[model samples]
Target: MSLARTLLDSAATTALVATMALSAPSARADEKVSIMVGGYEKQIYLPAKLTEALGYFKDEGLDVELLNEPAGVDAENEMLAGAVQGVVGFYDHCIDLQAKGKFVESIVQFSQAPGEVELVSTKHPEIKSPADFKGMSLGVTGLGSSTNFLTEYLAVKNGLKLGDFTSVPVGAGTTFIAAMQQDKIQAGMTTEPTITRLLKTGEASVLIDMRTMEGTKAALGGTYPAASLYMQTDWVEAHKDIVQKLANAFVKTQKFINTHSGAEIADKMPQDYYVGDKEGYVKALDAGKAMFTPDGIMPEGGPET
Candidate 1:
């Protein structure tokens, strides 16, 4: 089978990456492979962070460095600039760049669905659904980003044209919270921890939650592949073993997260990722745990659905 097909069909096992000893040495054993991720703390990309925290790359004899960029496209740009070997970003990017003739390939699929939720500030009881979105200011991660895409999709799904509601780019972390706290936006698209924090403060409530695959399918009308490890097709071709090793670690990490408790998994993550409330952070993580694919493969018809 072709490498791409091999990876796409990796749902059954993870032995593919262990063939490092048989690999042609395109990269030195000590070479550091930099992976740029959209956001480090969002629960959607937790497995990527978990792979790093558990020393999975080191254990596999691969030196992988994961850099965080709040906007996923920024991480993709970093890969294009030769600053990173791979980008852990939304799977739609592979299709986007492919259309532009760049032909990026997703080697490891992370989440089967977009782990985002539409939140409306408690102050605006009148703004309940997208029907009420007309003339309201909605928040997204950034213009032309995944969060923005979801926001736009939501707008269209509600039978209102894109411009009926204005989308302002309010980021995912603290910025997302501040937008709600200060009432800068009536509704916004954000991910976990931020979503969890908003509810804890009683300032925001879930207008549309897509943290679960079922919720994502219901909200987007299909499965929207969220996070994955992707790079230029040429890059993967040249560094097959290195890429495979990284994929192996992530597949293992996903399994670890599935079998473990949220608090135990959170313990492996950076302390700063927490919402300053341990219980809430764990609760958020638990809510989001089901989003990760067990074998690190995108589900059949994942992007299409």
Candidate 2:
């Protein structure tokens, strides 16, 4: 072969190889991202679940592993320890972690309203207003959770001092129910589908729908900043495209959920996740639907009153 012809052929080969390399799938394909959830199989983590079930994450070219922890700080710790790349929980907890230099950032707003955190009581039928909480024993998940904070906020708003009410940490779910049944607490804060079950069994009654409260609306523009997607700020910065893709997937799932009815969501959801009976699941789904926004914007001032 002539030298000139050979050189030309070599150049063409190199160009073709370069193009193929550029067009090849990313090397990061094998990379897996861990996502933390506060609970296992709960409706609060439905967006992430739906994203997995619908293959949205796979469509985005990501391998997402969902890890469930006992909600709150433990979940945050898993993210901090690099056990997970992200977490789904209260936006306030993200803020709190950020305040403590945990380097967490909220990627998407999941639940726009406080769907589950409610004050319920059958004994205090007369306790219709926040003011009635005075001298009441309120059940909370823990000391620094959104539950405790909101209950305290309610007390403050109602012209009652924080000391006026006692907050008993019931650890949520069946624990909250057991506490209520034992008369350990007169009022309790909890999320559905547990709340629905409690109400159905006449164990408790809804005293305040925090999702629809004026203060909550004022905070989140009629949306409660209940839960959201959170990630380590470092991870987000290092994987901007991936973070955006994840958010996009979640947003897609949110839209799909909104278009579907309660029965549809229940059908798609695993039976184990529905803590309430089927009817309770439907009620909770109907009530919780309005709390999730189609878009993933974390409203200013947090979730609505």
Candidate 3:
């Protein structure tokens, strides 16, 4: 087996054993944990739905409700407003929230790369690079999402000021595809299977690919860990048992991803997630599966990157 798979297996088994030994009161029977996932259908956040489909949550004696929100920013808001207990979204949000005096932490570091691609509409071939993004409308999941952050960072790195281009919140999936099709945006950053959908249609071509560690380092200079299961620190402190259970479930799911074939993992996902192209979805997952961390541990120097 691969190192990642071995580490993930070891971590999952260790966590389960540790949680089982805990003497803290078990989760309240009446309490159902709700997690809001940002674009759960997107392969970047697949573990959320996959874990649910695999019945890992129930196996841990936890009633977990998986909610879907297309935008990570909105998911963050829901968690802050108490609508959800946790968010399966970008790890950057935890850092962003911390700057504003909020305390949230990533309990499970899902992926070491952003799994995002900056695609330029095929109609705009003149846009060769971020340097050409001046006056362009860039699509992001939301105004304050990690997509937006990366968009701005790219723009600045390429010598473009924030005012030089507009950041449009076109959301993801169908809406994101719609924006590109209708020329609502010239270039945008998004995750798969939206990236695959757009590329398959020849509507967009990649300008910057952050979906893998090498691509991420080339674009952003180092490993930029993205998807994660993050919760408010206070809530985590008060619900150690529940947090431990969640960690166990997600770690197992990560191990599964590390070991299984793309088609095998696809079988565990919702049929609708295939977006009418099950084969394409499987192909895309296989291409980008390396972005996921095998051990559910944050990559070394990832946060600093």
Best by the lDDT measure: 3
lDDT values for all models:
0.78, 0.70, 0.87
Each model's TM-score, in the order given?
A: 0.89, 0.81, 0.91
Instruction: Evaluate model 1: give its TM-score.
Output: 0.89
Model 3 TM-score (2 dp): 0.91
Residue lDDT tens for model 1, 36-56: 888888888887889988987
Question: What's each prediction's clash count?
Answer: 2, 11, 0
Looking at candidate 2, the ten consecutive residues that score lowest on lDDT are 13-22
Sort the candidates on TM-score, descending order: 3, 1, 2
Query: What is the lDDT for 11 in model 2?
Result: 29
Q: What lDDT is reached at residue 83 by model 1?
A: 91
Over 4 Å off, model 3: 1-30
Each prediction's Cα RMSD?
Answer: 4.1, 12.7, 6.0
Evaluate model 2: give its lDDT.
0.70
**Root-mean-square deviation of Cα positions for candidate 2 versus the true structure, in angstroms:** 12.7
Deviation from truth (RMSD, Å), model 1: 4.1
